[model samples]
Target: MIPPALRIRGAVLVGPQEVRDELWVVDGRISFTAPTGTAARDVRTVSGWALPGLVDAHCHVGLDAGGAVDRPTAEEQITTDRAAGALLLRDAGSPADTRWVDDRDDLPRLVRAGRHIARPRRYLRNYAAEVEPDDLVAEVVTQAGRGDGWVKLVGDWIDRGVGDLAPCWPADAAKAAIDAAHAAGARVTAHCFAEDSLADLVEAGIDCIEHATGLTEDTIPLFAERGVAIVPTLVNIATFEGIARGAEEKFPAYARHMRALHARRYDTVRAAHDAGIPLYVGTDAGGSLPHGLVAAEVAELRRAGLPAQAALSAATWSARAWLGHPALTEGAPADLVVYPADPRADVGVLAAPDLIVLRGRPVAP
Candidate 1:
């Protein structure tokens, strides 16, 4: 493929506020970036500093069929043709990225851990097909082996005003899944919101915790010692009051669950940051959050006392690294965006991307 237009000169958010003097893309890799006089073919100046395309580590837009969630057999039955199979079906629960990338051409890329795995008749009760741990690992391994950035473990129903939630997968089960993923070179990301469930997941040796909740003074150091990462997804909880109030009409349990979700002391997140725990930003969109609105999560991290640049890196550079792409500089897949303001000073600029480059092609706005 022919190299798209090469971007040059502006404030590139590579690692915090470190802006290289210039940048350019060849075919699909960020070809050359250096001080003012960098050398490369097809030289044309791109107006703004280039940011590697945003990598939303926790998004779920794998396929279109997985949209209709929590519907009855009739609704879900017909919906099957739309989203029944396991291999695809993105689930409406994650509608945000469609707006973020497919609809607006905003970010470079967003990877997903697919639907959350839970026991039958639980929260993801409708769309998320629940299975025993033995079955779940096979499914998870199948997906993880596909070279996905990582694998997500989804239980710990306690976060919700949730059910006995079916006994969480036995520790042996969780570990088996974790081992399968690790053996395949993928880290496990769990969706936990309670201390007990978290302790179970921690025992499983997961690499990260998605939406970690009810963390105590003690839990922080354990994670630090193990070097696990935390993707608090704080904004989903912050705005949950509104989501619950709106959904109370249909999904009462959902409304109540959201309320409780918003109450916990993000102190866990704060402590994680204070203790130097790695953090990630995920919108948890679809069922709870609106799709394509990851910027709000970044803003929440900043509000939670994380530096603006740190929040930006969590979504950009750090996120990609967590997803297995350590070298986000030139020569990597060209996924980037150009915005009107300095992300370090004003994150609001993320809302309006002036230009977006994905895999080397700049989609004309």
Candidate 2:
């Protein structure tokens, strides 16, 4: 049954600077004023510093290290994120068809990117639709139709011949595939961890980049000029040291490159941000990493030199707008997290949301 209206007092942070003393959630939507017909007794009260539901801008919902998991496992992943107050997830890519999640209101809302499209034998096994350049455009078109207005590509991977990370798609192929995706009304993003792929992907009209550890001074301006956004997924990048170590013996060049990227990840991210390149928080969870690290990701962004408010916005208000979701605006769905203290003062408060409201229902406290 639908819950009665909730009268939320204290600081209602609707935007970065926009705040109201109080607000109400009626009929599953945010309302600035109390409903005229509702009696005082019908209103439940909650008070704190409220922010819109967190957004995991580049996460994988139904995927794991090996590939797609069953429905139960997927449900567990979603619950983990929801408990962390990540109400909006941009599923960067997933092999599984998690469309069933939309029917489950208890789960966080998802913006799927269909599945990862990669060159044969280039990406993790079973995690992508491995194809040749000849088929890149067709594959992109297919994924675009299946996804919720987004398509993910494995723009770079380790080349066994070179024993180092290299661009996966040629410039022409990338341009064709990205154009095809745009034609189908979807934005294209790529998984890139090395510098080789940045220029091609950005030049091809890509919308975003995941794990953009490759962003360098030379390419930062291009991304800023094109208005391409990036989700650093710094939490996942933190694992690069281990990844490099694992490949040290077999692929020394790749290992060294990974180490270099890890060593300067912060500087790279900060440089991109300073150059006006958009940044967002993404844990890169569900593939080797555990779920529920949105707060940690936000903290990592701060460590990368984003100011407190900008870092918080990477996962809150600005992130929501980037993903095309509403924040605490009137008539929008009531998905928000409340903390005892203002998150802008210390983003660590996001790690322990005092209250979590989803679709106007007080789901967690």
Candidate 3:
């Protein structure tokens, strides 16, 4: 059933600084002006502070710690995120085919990266397309074509033979693979956790980095200059200590490195933000972490020293723009969340949305 037209009252945040007193949702699109002939009684009135639906910049719907899940699990994952007000998700990498989701209006929109490209045995088992450096370019092209304008790479991981974290691909191979992805019209992002992989990947023209815990003074400037973005996934990084403890007996050096990274995780994120490198919020959910933690990820960004508004933007306005999606604009889909108070005042309000409008329908909180 088509929902009745909605009259949104109070302040609507069209962007960080842009706000309007009222907005209308007609048929499923936003309209600044009221409908021509609809009677006042026909439009449902919702009063609150409204903002664009949240975006989870990095999430995997059809995946879990063990790998691809069934369709029922994937549906559950999308439902969890929708309840959190994350109406758009960038599936950074997932082994399962979740294309069926795009057909469901009730589900959050997804931007999928076909799968993670990793060196054989270097990343988590069953989570990526394992390929050697000799096959890197070919795999990148394949994933790029399979993905929705983006590709994921496992740039660094523990080298059991070396007893520490190391770059998975040589600099030359990294450059060639990135070039191939670009040639295929896809932007490339890599999962990076240590310093060694930072420079080579950034220099290779990769579009973004996930879990960029290794950013430092030298590399910070390069990332800022190149306009390369990072999704720190600080919520996921919180588990580094536990992971280190689990692997300590087998890889002592790696454990120490993980501890060091965890110790300075906040400082690393703060430094990147200060250097003007673009930072987006990502919970790294669907891999050990539960879904619907977009609010938690935003709070984690605040804890990392980003100002309240900046932190909010990482998941809302700026994030939508970065992903080329619309937010509270005329003719755009009516996907928004309303709060009893201004979220700009305290993003914690995100955890308790008064109303969540997906497309044109009001979702129960």
lDDT of each: 0.60, 0.91, 0.93
Clashing pairs in 3: none
For model 2, the local distance difference test gives 0.91
TM, every model = 0.76, 0.98, 0.98
Query: What value does the lDDT take at residue 297 in candidate 2?
Result: 92
What is the clash tally of candidate 3?
0
Could you give candidate 2's per-residue lDDT for residues 1-365 as a string of tens digits?
A: 44578888999888878889998889889999788764444888888999999999888988999999999999999899999999999998999999999998888999999999999999999999999999999999999988999999999999999999999999999999999999999999999999989998888899999999988888999999999999999999999999999999999999999999999999999999899898998999999998999999989988988888889888988999998999999899999998899888898999998889999887764
Error of 3 at 77 (Å): 0.5
Per-residue lDDT, model 1, residue 204, is 80
lDDT of 1 by residue, 166-279 (tens): 236788888888888888777677777666666667778888887776567778888887888887878666766775677787667656655665675465677788888888
Which of candidates 2 and 3 is the stronger one according to lDDT? 3
Candidate 3 regions with alpha-carbon error over 4 angstroms: 39-41
Lowest lDDT block of 10, candidate 1: 81-90
Candidate 2 stretches greater than 4 Å from native: none
Residue pair clashes in candidate 2: none
Ranking according to lDDT, highest score first: 3, 2, 1
